[model samples]
Target: MGNITETKVYMLDTNVFRYKSNPRAHKSYKKATKRFWRNVLQEFRNGESVLYIPKEVIRELEVQSYTLSEKENQRIAQLLELIEETVPDLATPEIEHQIRKITAYVRSEYKSDINAARDMEYGSVSDARILLAAWQYDCIFVTANIKDFMLYPLLFPQNESRLFDLLSENYVIIDPTVYENIHRDPVFAGMLQDLHNMLER
Candidate 1:
């Protein structure tokens, strides 16, 4: 296993996959973002990183299939096949244990609709179970659905930290924009350039 310093294992949200294949969300997305998808996958191929996804996430995505062309669906299929190589097969024994315990706790403690907001925000039963699993695994919650989980940091004030801290609290919910700005950010780009220069010299 690689040290935490080098490889940041990220739990990808469903929308990242969706945004790539389905052109329905953004009117101009297909024409607009040719390079964006390329860069994200490049990071995956190069980073020596683990792309962890809860089985639930994949199941949900698979079930919620959108209308797309034969070519687009075929592309998504091929992409998933490649991604499967890098995605760590998590959500195994520990996830099963956590889900049982967490479900019991939530059903016993929270039955009212008042906390339903939080429940639904976290995607109710499965999500609560998944978050607990994320905590156990010590991975960042990489998601385009930031709004779905932003309440996490707010609800648990102690979980707050900067973007760089991947394993701070329960999970670090990285927005898709974080990947978008990877090489474009002046600070990080300059640092990368300096590192490159040092390595070359």
Candidate 2:
């Protein structure tokens, strides 16, 4: 077991939970994803790492769930229940302001980026809220939709140094694919190993 003081914290994006709960997802991939989440929950229960779900993310999921079949909706509800039991929903007064600011800035300034434009058009502003929460908590932000989150720092040239500082301190934005293939991804493997070493110390 890991030391409590050395516990790593993770803030999950909506896509992570959605993909896990997706009924049409391939059986093998679903199995692997469930195994991955089970390990994460076990670690959380052991006080090895913290897991969080932003209120905005939950809102997005809840909105989407209405369109899904009853079975899929139940799956999402169960997943939400598990997450709520594991960690408190994060919210802050600044979150609304931050989301609006991010959406407007990215839409006006980085309009050339199609992904950013589509995210804005599709009302995935949850990304901005989730990012704000991750920044507030200084936790690793994990997501399946990495492009949107990865573009956050690049939008502001003035904050380049601040963004670099966060990256260097290991307050990183990670894609779940990295964890799924840690063996082939040296950077991912190294990060996880470092966390393990910290806990051992």
Candidate 3:
């Protein structure tokens, strides 16, 4: 984690809103996720940081919520209440242009691999917008699906170098299913440390 300390803006992905208990996950992992969100709420309440969810992510969550279990739906509803700031509107022409360019790049790059192309095409537009929004707004993009966002830089480093650098220095990746892979974002690391300390207590 970087030593940089200042008020921060965090751009959250849709998956971060999920707190559904998974049967296969260890109990501690679920507890950690809950603690993570609790810390988020604390930060929000204290106005120490800004948490932003793109409008696209919110819409995606609403669509997915329809198929989720009642317990999970309730958790999502509670999580939604933590949105203290307005959702960032990602529908501008500039954003649309970036999304199209990214889509074209993904398609052209993965032309030889049909399955890869399909996967890229599936959610690339939305993912691209989210990634771009994080970059555009200079916000730390937090998500459980690190690989998905990391794929852009790994594939096309030339255009996404700035974004790559930002993510490297400030982002947070929280894999809800496991305790080990949660990484980066100094603020979040501190929060995770506090959670660990509480568990020890």
Tally clashes: model 3.
Answer: 0
Give the clash count for each candidate: 0, 0, 0
lDDT of 2 by residue, 1-201 (tens): 854467767777776676678878766556656765787789878878776777777787878877778887777777666553233334343443444444454445444443333343213455656766665566556665544565344322322221211112222222333223333445433543453343345
Range of the 10 consecutive residues with the lowest summed lDDT in candidate 2: 159-168
- Flag clash pairs in model 1: none
Q: Which 10 consecutive positions of candidate 3 have the poorest summed lDDT?
A: 173-182
lDDT of 1: 0.47
For model 1, the superposed segments whose C-alpha errors exceed 4 Å read: 1-5, 27-37, 66-69, 84-122, 151-201
Cα distance off (Å), candidate 3, residue 174: 18
Q: What are the Cα lDDT values of the candidates? A: 0.47, 0.54, 0.53
Better of 2 and 3 by TM-score: 3
Write one digit per residue (lDDT tens) for candidate 3, span 1-201: 986556667777776666333333446545655565676677777777777778788888889878777787777777767664645664455445445454454344442342322233424567766765665566666765554464333222232232211222333222232212223334434543453343344
| Residue 172 accuracy (lDDT) in model 1 | 41
Instruction: For residues 1-201, write the lDDT of model 1, one tens digit per residue.
Output: 756546655665555566667757574444333343464467668875556666666666667666557666776676566553233333444443434443343334332322333332334455544554354455556544443343233222243431121112223433344333333546444543443343344
Least well predicted 10-residue stretch by lDDT in candidate 1: 161-170
Off by more than 4 A, model 3: 1-5, 20-32, 91-123, 151-201
